[model samples]
Target: MDCGPGDEGDGSSPVTTPTRTSSTPGRPSPPAEPSTAGRSSAAGRPFIAGQSSTAGRPFTEGQSSTAGRPSAPARLLASPAGVHAHARIAARADPHGRTVLPVLDGEGPLALRRTRATGPAAHVTLVGAMSGPLGGDSLAIDADVGAGARLSVGSAAATIALPGQDGAAARYDVRLTVADGAELRWLPEQLISVRGSALRVTTRADVAEGGRLVLREEQVLGRTGEEPGLLHSRLTVRYAGRTLLDQELTCGPGAPAGWDGPAVLAGHRAVGQLVVVRPEFAYESPESAVLGESAALTPLAGPAALITALAPDALRLRHILDDALSRLM
Candidate 1:
């Protein structure tokens, strides 16, 4: 079965969009409201002690800098723009049956580092070099596990998407391949969608016959007490050339009506899913059942199982997913 998801959007061009104030690490602070004591009001009459008539303008034309150099806003405008980056990882088994990482390449904002593994599997962690996946940025990560090898990949922190100068939608793509008899575990941190940002994510995994996979994905709608931006995600998994799962989800503006309604998110701020594929499932399939209030575990048509859950925050979501993973595995 090839159940591909529908297109989300082109996201090829930049369009001006409104952004909100944010204090996320690596995000720039919005320029302060400029003083408008001498400007004319809309009615051609200016009053008020410390207010500006220019409703939305950041600063007036004749405003002079504190020094000979440009103002802070000007300096911010000249800062480096978003980046296009790709990171790659390859794990192979040695003659002694130990997993080894022959390729761990990091680029731009997507820095890949080899970390200490708890078991035979080689571990790799993602480290962000700078703030990104901002609007207009394109990021991708490719990982491959050779036959008979075991590998695990994780991230150091949550990814925060912020609006860029161009206002374009940012994109992050992940591709994974596991050869026969190999195993892979992809456990990344949550992704937080800040207000006024737009992000699109695609994750595709191909597992050969006898290969095993454990993957997790989590999304946080927004920060504490704040409205979310736009977030679209698609997850596709193929086992031995057959599509096991292909799902798409969208939230915030432009999503399907009532996405956050009772039938969907139900006012939840965090959502996540876990997929586990192993050869053992072919003989003894797991039973479908609900795990608590907002989570379910069901066996797929093939030798695989899926666990989906929702929660009010990232902590609760992680706890739910973790509990489900323990039960399933």
Candidate 2:
């Protein structure tokens, strides 16, 4: 049977007789063959109509079709070493209606840009821009600092979040390598993990002999409203194969019942940590207050400086260190 385009086998068309040519006087003419190229043709019908070509065999759609469906999430790998300066990482919805830029910075003066969003849950995007906010749907950052290169990291506004039942989370892993005689100053804005939210950050720095690393991390919790605590954070710092600092803070339900003890938080709400490692660096004793006030300072037994603060709030702790950092610079 001859089939044309746009025709289905409903048996509505009239049958047409086939023309016959005799090859030999005694042999009957062979049946005419059907065209196999068109969808209406029998040979192409099975494939185009989504039917099995082989009898009793089922047809299976592979990745090309299944790709449209949302499946389980796949694991993804991110390397800060591969990113250039002034790059965006990720952005997401927040209770406060503001955008969150996880990581953003570069390797020169004005190496980092800071900005704030207007509304609650605003869409944040990161693009490679020369000026203005570096936008991204997720995180943003610069992972590379050439040998002997200098860079400074900072954020523009206090990241805020609204109250919500379901918690939010973010993770940052930064690896910095400073060659001999090089210096790196990393001063990122405070991270605000509002009540009921959780955040985890890990930073590793590899510095050669004679290299200098100045680093600071500030976190605030429950900025918008009153809550037991604003953040639960864990931080680890290492230098030249020696562990410089290992600290963890868990507020609220699982917080240490004796956190008010002299050895613990001493009933303070906000906390900050700063570590500076250099071959020949000098820091006053824990008795020397960081903010000229009667603040608490804990000095490790080795060549690193570790200071902890219990401020009225996370914001206070952030500013205390910000002022201290300006002096160090």
Candidate 3:
């Protein structure tokens, strides 16, 4: 099977369409309201005065100090084709942060939602979403792609904020399970952590026999005019039970400063990862070389068929994807 752009439904840009399943229930039920007594302020004022109170400590009076913060959770909207796949997408605020409200809506051809703030360290999980950005109040995504499903995930835009100074560092954990003959394509937007911001991201995937998977992750530092920011990134990818890729990049004033060298980033402002895995199909020499040059691609030397690429721009990365898919076709 070609399994490329044209081979799929329409050739227009891909979008995520979420549908509910028993495995992935509807949006979380709204939390119960606090009692009248619990709504009073510490200064003896009524609940109205307590609405904007900041002097109280965290998690006091059955109300969290971090309530009503900004959080962007995952949403799986319906696709244009209306192909019903058993998919699940859910999120839980981290123990340290506040619980956020995850909005769920279907907009034409895409499903959309934002995570209302819980507190700091609130984390959301996507059991399943086709493709789009995952934003928290802190601005990041923690995603998982299950077995036997074709999932192509991405972000709405580039994230430039970080933790502490601006907020907590954005983090993502993507786990993929590709069953026999299943496929997954994850293409999230680039992540740009500002100078004072911090980020920690990781992705892992499990591929069964005859299964296929494709993944892309990009990280950038500094805005067009802002000074270069700090970035701490670690990526790990697993196939079956074996580790296929492990890399760590820490860029900051205090960290080592040799990334400009030829072996490292070579002063490129952006970096990315594109991976494709299949058991039967293989890349030809010409196609392999083209992919290698476009994204500085690399192939895993093992029983599994996996290709990885690192790029400096989204356009180039997309071009590489097109070429790779064309070759596969």
Candidate 4:
């Protein structure tokens, strides 16, 4: 089924159509007072005032498509035949050191939402209104952290990227720019890759000498009783003009034979990676951070720490990663 997800629109107004069930339900229930719900969080840090946007709505809730949303000057998508969409966000810090989200825009099925601030970090989540990704679908998130600022990014839940009938693959690309003396914690929970789905993720991070990065990526090949899809993920990290980590992993139904080996994922169905760009973060050898015989962590060859592992499911992967992150600076 080639579902184009209708015409794409920038994240400038409210969502009017009903949501499809194929996409995960990531939105919390409507708050009592919608105006003050943007700054709502269930953890440390005083709520610094914000609002939650829906898969169709912009950064403001209860507002019409043209009534009360921030004007996005740059919008794309000039056709209705393709499924490609784009979402861009810019973040900075106030004089008090609190992170602030300035730009959040999306066009197509993919949406961007800014949730509450958690522990001095601005929280943002991506919501897909369609059943999932179709062929040629693209989503990009760009974050610019000012000097001395801190940003934390999280997904409400897992994203399922399903393949379309056009023989084309879906893509999700993220670019992060950490300024001097800044930090960013990207903790995306998981991505469920369905069978026959060709999904590729390119994550590029440019960190300053004094900047810090604690990034994590969790991947599940397929759900219970399902065959694995095709997943090709690449990570490129550079600090002060030097490449710290540049690696790529490809597997699933379309992978070449002899790709299965003990040296690569073994027999695990899920995988996770936790990368710390700065040496200041405390971390032990990947061999020591073990969940069980089903999961193992191995550090990528680099000057900085690039820890990657495989597990049986998302919960176990998260457990191992959470412990690893707790030990970081």
For each of the candidates, give the backbone clash count. Answer: 0, 22, 31, 4
* Residue-by-residue lDDT tens digits, candidate 4, 42-145: 44221111233343212222112223433331222232223455556566777777666555554344445566453666666554334355445666777777
Worst 10 residues of 1 by lDDT: 1-10
Supply candidate 1's per-residue lDDT for 302. 98
Per-residue lDDT of candidate 1, residues 74-119 (tens digit): 4333434445666678888888888776666555456555555568
lDDT of 3 by residue, 202-240 (tens): 566666666666776666656554544556666666656
Which portions of model 1 show Cα errors greater than 4 Å? 1-81
Give the lowest summed-lDDT range of ten residues in model 2. Answer: 128-137
The candidate maximizing lDDT is 1
Q: On TM-score, who's better, 3 or 4? A: 4
For candidate 3, give the lDDT of residue 281.
41
The deviation in Å at residue 182 for candidate 4 is: 1.3
What tens-digit string does per-residue lDDT give for candidate 2 at 1-329?
12111112212321222111121122111122222111122222211112222221111111111233332111011321111222322222223433333333222111222222232221111111111111111223434333443444444334332222223343434556655655566656565555544444456666666666777776655554555432445666555666667777766444667654566666565667777766664344333455655254455554556656557677678777766655443
* Clashes in predicted model 1: 0
Each prediction's Cα lDDT score?
Answer: 0.72, 0.40, 0.41, 0.60
Better of 1 and 2 by TM-score: 1
Q: After superposing candidate 4 on the true structure, give the runs of residues whose Cα lies further than 4 Å from its correct spot.
A: 1-13, 18-81, 279-303
| Model 3 ranges with Cα > 4 A deviation | 1-147, 166-170, 281-294, 303-317, 320-322
Task: Give candidate 3's total backbone clashes.
Answer: 31
